[model samples]
Target chain A: MLRPWMRCSKNWRAMWNNFKSKFLGTNFKRFMGFVKKEFYHIFRDKRSMFILFGMPIAQILLFGFAITNEIKNVNIGILDKSKDSETIHITNRISSSPYFKIKNIVSSEQQIEAIFKKGQVKAVLVFEKDFGKNLKSTNLANVQIISDATDPNTANTVTNYIQSILQDYQREINLGIPGREPIEVRSRMFYNPELKGVFNFLPGVMTVILMLVSAMMTSISIAREKEQGTMEVLLVSPLKPLQVIIGKVFPYIFLSIINAIVILLLGFVVFGMPVQGSYFLLALETVLFILCALSLGILISIISKTQQTAMMISLMGLMLPIILLSGFIFPVSSMPWPLQAISNIIPAKWYNLILKGVMIKGVGLRFLWKETLILLGMTVFFIVLSIKKYKIRLE
Target chain B: MQALRDITFEVKPGELFGLIGPDGAGKTTLFRILTTLLFADEGTASVAGMDVVGDYRDIRKAVGYMPGRFSLYQDLSVEENLDFFATIFGTTVEENYDLIKDIYIQIEPFKKRRVVALSGGMKQKLALSCALIHKPKVLFLDEPTTGVDPVSRREFWDMLKRLNSTGITVLVSTPYMDEAELCNRIALIQEGELLVVDSPENIVANHTDSLYKVAAKNTYMLIKDLKDFKGNKSVYAFGEFIHYTHSNSDFSEERLGEYLEAKGHEDIKIVKARAGIEDVFMALSEKKGTEV
Candidate 1:
């Protein structure tokens, strides 16, 4: 009793359903298989696993505790030629500040040279014979600060700290005098009021660790297949080139996410660094950066024929630029014009900006949309280039 | 540099085909093209009745390739490697267990061991098992026994023969001429060109010259003396004797004996020898060189 059209439509629906299941079911299974295999490869190699999980924590601790730019407790030799009450008071004031630790009270200039030569003190502060008399008679006291210029950065910082301490002491002495209070520049440091170097470096460290782990790991892995001749087998399989790339990179994405989390936790617990913004926004930015880095890795792998070449390229080409130009250590505003322009193209620079904006500035998507878009664009560009290069090379 | 040039041959379904060549003979290049890993710049290639370039997806599903090197994940265990390949092919190990069971059983006890720890033969066996996991209609093995021992090489060939019995066409390439005899059909290649394509027996039968094996007190000196002999076309040492071919069609044993005697060779033995695939290969190579 059924019409002919009804039977035809029923057959058509059955064919469509069969095709959908066959296509999607097989692809999903194959992709899952690839991802599982990748995980096995990662987990079985203890060395790589250690690098993946342990390195971020170690680096965070190392950067937080050992490597610092702030000066604290610098040993300084004081040459007090006058044993007057004023000189004693100045000496006490200098020693009382946390920035300077007076190692010796030298009686002569020769003693100052000897202490500096022994490398016990970084700088020598010499007060003149009539220090109080000069300040009372002429409203000027001459104090000589001779610092060892061997390490210019430390020497400069030590000298600046002593000068600030002396200025503070002078203000205290002039508190009772009329019209003699120096112009006090009460500069309040914003964002990081404590001036902790850890606050400045943690974001840079996050950027660098994510870049190294995600980019270097992926590039070396893909190039290793080429070196071992396994890429040929994979290419000959039913997996497309893009699928092969995604399969290889899928596990790394998860690892990088874990790495980012570990870095954030270490920064919070060990360094007491703040995450002022929403954790969701921070995570989204981190994933964006990781994708950008991974795409760059794919591009490098497509160009390199061997694992060694890939590794070298990643280190020298990617790591160096990220460290030097991404405002990680050196301020981008201070770099030369050409280098600054070049840094604009470096993906890490934008990522570091986004990280700082979200983590330190507590900004939302409205403030970070530009940097996020740039990173996303770079990721697309790198992926397209890599796919084009891969096709050309394979052909 | 051009790795392959003017290469032309055909392999029938279910035939055990071999590509016999020396090092740098472009055997790997040909296999790469046939497996859809590379494209031919000038000519066309098809596998399983599909164009290599256009129908690569279908070809990939229809073919299984074992590259010239051990290409498995060295960090993964034997079981993991096998399971990975099976899963990627959209099939389970149990579904095609019969195809690879013969080879996989040999390495089953060490299934937990990483591939890097496996011996050379075990590695090749594992690689072969991975390739056959999908039960494709065609299998391409490039230099599977290059570094394998003699005993393992024999066993690997036996495995291939057993697989071929189940109607899977196999294309194997090797530098060893002796392996050519095991193939139903072989193509001898040199310097990226096809030298000959035929059954091993037919190629050996087609050897043109009358060959001789001569040995004396010092085989090295015998080779020198035979090279200086007037009728010598080619003289090379083969294991315990020197295999020599003559310029003239009518080769006389008495002439060679007297020639060796004149050169003060003692304990001289001379006999007619049958040409093998090696001899045919050498002759064809020399012919191509002279023509070029």
Candidate 2:
């Protein structure tokens, strides 16, 4: 009985030897040179070097800290028009709850808007005059909770917290008064109910990693050829334009797939994310995603005159939209109609949806067909544009 | 051979054909078209009898192009860059080992070094090896020696001569006039047009104006005063001397020297000399609207 770690190390060594034998053939010397060259490029560019390694860590930390579903210690402002015992009791209950922290108690309505503008308060709770007297006679009271909806998600969370606090008070009142009929309401959240950010983020990370590695990296590489004057050499060679593009993009595609695998492994082992659908289908989708990204890279390369311009275009034009409109962190369904319409044009939105459906829901082609078709269409469109642009440059 | 606007000249097999021109003289544009990297909107061009556009793929297979800049894969090692170019032609360094053996041997010790880490000369040799890896029939080197040091330029030219001896047609472009003399045939082009195409000696012999090299202690004043001489056709500074060629037969070198001396000039030395290719090029190219 061999030790597990030792056995695994020996197997890894064997696989490594096999891989070397296959690619390196009799020339281990040349293969080492190639790998050294790849390392040189990875290390020479400080920005890309950071993005290659540091970005994932930063994203994880940011998602873990800033973008959270669980709301706690949210700053709330209360306005009590009546200084009665019932009003004070409700105010104490609201403030003492772990979820809400009252930043101020305002006596005037004008102070509510000023406190909100100063960013000291996230939500303002208001109680009307003679609220205890009204509750005693009519057995009903109305209170208003106003939240700053600049960041709609946080605003929504604050409002929900206020509503829950109010309900707790109502429950206490109901217990005191017997024979009171309580209409029961049950709530169920759709899609991701528990709001595990990783569950929502892993697929988004996959899209971004694939796009950055495939599109931005490939475009920069191609534009680099033009900048260095090697493009002319390749163009003048007997190799066709298609052959040249294929050669440039092929290496990146392989590298991006490897990157994708690294991310997926991290997602699985570290985050405990399970792949519900067929691994083969997921791999197929990854390949399709790579093709779409590569075509976009080709298109970017065609439009750019230098590596810098290509990189800027890929960053500002492509990556931003993918991150913002793809419904990776934010739900596209809850966005304004104009924004929803705009999200439809983004390829990452569909890919994110497809990944969620396949990995989380175990849905197959029936659910993913539209996304696949959209990706394919985008690929074709980009390929055609790049080809046309390439021809024009030649002429 | 089909002409670029009635200029018909063919580079003999294994000949070093040079295009000497200034910037914007269309040297790169012409090179691009001939190398199959671009298509000329009009007129016909071919490499080794294969049309540039129709037979582009074959031409690409048959030609080795080294553009103005050192354009090997910089991020890759010298050896990996070499291997990649070799692989592109469906061959390995071992298969065509003899073709780049000389250049490859020079950079062999640095095989493990990344191309971006290599010196300018090393980069040049690597590019040349990558270009010749496919054993091309026609080699188009576009200003390959432009920014390189003098020694490197000489070394590069020597390598080209060596490659040409193997029966590969070499078409080299350069802005340096001295390099034009090294070519078996030279084309002088300016302003997107070919001015003259001929052997260096023949072009020099075709100088239609009389030439004189006049120098004085006050060389600056001599040039300034000589330009104002009534019978002088052209008077321009060449090196430390003023070269004044007369169009009027009545104008004498003695009279010009006398005029310079009267202006308080010293060490006046006037001599009749043979015109170089550059002089002939200047004379011909200066003629506005002169067609090649």
Candidate 3:
């Protein structure tokens, strides 16, 4: 026992020492050390390296080209038996519509199958004999549109485009003619007038990449420590649970941001995608979405005991749902009602809505506050859940 | 249902304490509990005058633990791994270089090499260095020499001795009974219960029996015949001989020799033998097993 004043001074010294040790940015520096080790892990491991850098580019290219769903510059063959002015007029009309390029004129019907089998042409237009004479006297003419049915969707889209072009020609020819009426249905698709799938895929691919790079990579890396038994060592150290979680998650935030930027840049430059809303809002929302995914990743890591289990859960659990329920590939509205309701709980679905609002729809926070709040709420929920789920010891 | 039962022991400051047990003798379980990495069901444990559960944060700061498995990052270079652990513990390697210099220097030549490329001995040295980087007051090592070569195991024990002399309380567990002799005191644990706790010399000294090394040509049959001996108290087979202890203190070797001779044994060599830590361990374990 000592005098009160002397005891108070000793306590003061102890407090200062504690403060200097615990605070004063030592934790920050230690957190940085953890992050530095994480970079070593990501850089030295080829699987993480590839997913961190290569997958974004590959996915962008894949979605940009493979599933474009646009009908542009499609080569087509025309078999004209009539050799009349009307037939020539229709052929020129089809060629100039920007949907079809007349590759070659087939003289006989047999050549149509030959070109299609050779994969030279996607479709062929065949006209019957005396086509102009029949249209003038009988008020009717038949033209058969034969398309390559290997890819049924592309074939259907091509057929629709050609049919629309033919209808446009008929409307132009029948305008103001006596006793002859051809109904015209003019439909306009807003925001994307050319009906480019790239516009849709920009957000879709962005959603998928952010979810994967943030969630899957983080979970796998964390599970990797558990498998390697370094997690036991980490727990035994002076590092707090918060420090470990943030240390394990912060690098991925940085990397996922890089991935976000890469996806946005590719979508903007390569595919001519637009960022119609505020760039600040876009970046903020991107980070929020990334945080949501990172927290989900932490939750996944908490549940998994091994890297293989984490990978399987990420791929089978996260990827398919993010790709499917997020409306990245298929429209959520078209899905069955139960699935549509289930999509509401998916963070990707909400992030997809926000991304489309800001990037494609050119709407600000005023218009997208609901989706943004939903995403923010989901992020908070996941963070809270993961914090609850995290283990403080090696149980 | 339980990993450790009624296990109790204390290590004085600066003592090299050893937990001697077989593979599944709850050595790792006890270590984990003391390190604050695990919880006990029925009892409480403390480390460095702090409760393991309530003051776990403080205990974590004061102790350095090396798990049974190799737990360092395999993909990281040796220097990088050391730096990483030092940093996470809120200290730099240069700040605590003197603490681990003895062990770190042995593997420093391979500092830039990945841990996966290092040999088992070098890895153990590096692991010890990493554990010591923070200069913890107490060190818990679980099976540090389980897979190491004989020469490296000897060198590792020497390092542990040096570290212990530096005023760090070392609590190490090993399945090798011979290594227990190197410790200042050893606890023989088996099946979640502690059998005995004493210095290695005292444990062997307490084994008061006129032990004899009896070997014959038919060694395999010797095990059965020796077990069938009515006067035998304990019979454990060592590498070249079967160590035997008789119930009677001053049993005559000539009478045993005559009995074996009548049993058609040749090249029979019966001579006195001294008990080691291993023999004591086997005898204690067997006694415990039979009692249970």
Q: Write the per-residue lDDT of candidate 2 for residues B175-236, one digit (tens) a residue.
A: 98889888889999877767888888888877768889998887777878888888777778
Alpha-carbon runs more than 4 Å astray in model 2: A1-46, A73-156, A165-178, A197-202, A259-280, A329-340, A392-395, B1-5, B95-109, B206-209, B248-252, B287-292
Positional deviation of residue B44's Cα in model 1 after best superposition, in angstroms: 2.1
User: Quick one: best TM-score, which candidate?
Assistant: 3
Ranking the candidates on TM-score from highest down gives 3, 1, 2
Could you give the CAPRI-style class of model 3?
high
- Using all chains and alpha carbons, the TM-scores for the candidates as numbered come to 0.91, 0.81, 0.94
| Clash pairs for candidate 2 | A237-B60, A238-B60, A238-B61
Question: Runs in model 3 with CA error above 4 Å?
Answer: A1-22, A96-98, A103-120, A136-140, A175-181
Candidate lDDT (C-alpha), each: 0.89, 0.80, 0.90
What is the docking quality class of candidate 1?
medium
Candidate 1 per-residue lDDT over residues A1-395, each given as its tens digit: 87988887879888776876888677777888888988887887787788898888888889888898788888988888877788889888888888889898888877877888899999988889889998987779999999998899899988888888888888888897988888998879877888788887899988998998889989988888888877877888887677788988999999999888888888888878899899999998899899999999988988898989999999999889999999999999999999999999999999999888888889899998899999999999999898888852254
Tens-digit lDDT track of model 3 for A149-235: 999998999999888877877777778887777655778887788778888888988898899999999998899999999999999
Candidate 2 lands at a TM-score of 0.81
